[model samples]
Target: MGWLTMTRMAMGGHETPKAYLDAQLTYERKAEGDTPFQGLRVLKSVYSGSTYYAAAERYDENGKRIYVTAIICLVRWNPRASDGHIFGYKDMDEDMGPCEASCPRSVLALLTTTSHPFALDWRRRCYRMLALRERRIADGDLIRFPEPMKFTDGSEHREFRIRRDGQKTVLTLADGRGRFKISRLLERRFEIVREPKVAKTFFPAA
Candidate 1:
């Protein structure tokens, strides 16, 4: 057969319609998550407009109502169809999902307006981990916190401590009010030494 005839036959033969074949192919690709820009890397500019604030109402020793404000810095990773990433302001109360689990480039860092007694040590430990891993982080790169760092589900959430030993880093998870105490309250602990993979930036240059 001639080239044109062979081409037509290979596409769908005489019985099957070309348009139907094309539609089927498109549906298959979509099912396989093969949409356009599937593996593209995008860069997100850091949020710098305002400081996010959260308040918790509580009673002091004297039973006086006082609102404790928490100043939070949120770093978000947004993926786009184009070449570069986009960053914009998000509401302080908006529920930002755990980007570490979804997108490796997104992160949420929480800081308090004042050192609250409840979470002072926990915040300090988190800060130390950030400092130690700073050298490996780029301006727009996201670092994945080791496993067991989540604090959402009250039942599953536990405090964590990150430490560096020789060439490996360790993450320790514990329950209760004490710091680094391995007791019945100590839920579980594990160690991870591998450095997190840094995400590539697709931001356009000035």
Candidate 2:
């Protein structure tokens, strides 16, 4: 549980919490009819620097509100620096809960400026399924987009969409039956898909 390597010095411009988690997180809005990607379109970073993102959200046990996927990596993606980056990512079948959901790898309120401590023992290892049974995915793959959850008995939030399955590398979660595999320190070579649920499975048994 000690393997974090993010070295990209050149931000004399200041701001380091690993460059504010590699700054560049959009798609903000969810809850109720939630899915992932905060409702698609807001994704940026095909190369930018100072990137460190993590995704995977599922809440229940009476907390209600499920579905959220993400894992956009690039925390040390310095291909000699030039914005050539990207490191980790996430996803789900819009499954909804009980099938076991939790694969975030770290989330102390998303590491509030990484100074450690305040109370952060985040390390979600495994949990996320919708009877997960298919396989195969491609197209510049690097999965994980689950984290699109929201609630506000005051305003109103609930959106979804992080669906994938194309180009070809392999990361399918139900094309043939729903498969999985998107973790390897992301040194290149990614292809896992699973975001074709589109909200409609709230919770009752998972």
Candidate 3:
């Protein structure tokens, strides 16, 4: 597992597969939603010069996390295609499937050919989870947007700021109870309200 640090390199200018996928998962539609980024977390990953293989965790219907495998390649994400622009780079492609005995053929082929330790450990985790009938995420939950702060009394601040708390990015208020994710603010709908006027300097003219 420690070798992952040394063997890993930027794939398509992204430091990790999760970052690459999230960057390409944006959408611009009338029914804009953030479900694509919802509860998706990458657990184990390995990549060749062109192909990326990884194990991902996703929440199922019963609020249980399930282990899934994915194969992401540049061929699956074509820039010249219209669907790639309309949906997402990976949304239109059939690139992911289960990680257990019912895994997809594409993932199976890649796994069989490679002797990478990360890949082997990833397979072991898949089997172990399946055997226990528990697919709980080993790497913990995905980064989630925090609850928006409520301002029930109609009090507002003149200015605000954004800052990071460890792995989380949050917006701050001068006198608020807790920090809020920028995404949460966007979801809650924010307006400029009013801009502060520039202060005039009093100086003697020469």
The best candidate by lDDT is 3
Worst 10 residues of 3 by lDDT: 1-10
Candidate number with the higher lDDT (1 or 3): 3
Each candidate structure's TM-score, on Cα atoms with residue i matched to residue i, is 0.19, 0.20, 0.24
Model 1 lDDT per residue over 101-163, tens place: 111122224222444454454345434444444444222222233443433343333334444
lDDT of 2 by residue, 120-179 (tens): 112221312111322332353434444422333232212221234553234443333333
lDDT of each: 0.32, 0.33, 0.40
What are the per-model C-alpha RMSD values against the true structure?
Answer: 24.8, 21.9, 21.7
- TM-score between candidate 3 and the true structure: 0.24
Candidate 3: tens digits of C-alpha lDDT, residues 77-181: 233544333112222112322232322233443332335565555455545444433322221122222333445555544334545557555555633344544
Q: Give the clashing pairs for model 1.
A: none
Residue 12, model 1: Cα distance from true site in angstroms? 51
* Candidate 1 displacement at residue 26 in angstroms: 48
Among the numbered candidates, top TM-score falls to 3
Better of 1 and 2 by TM-score: 2
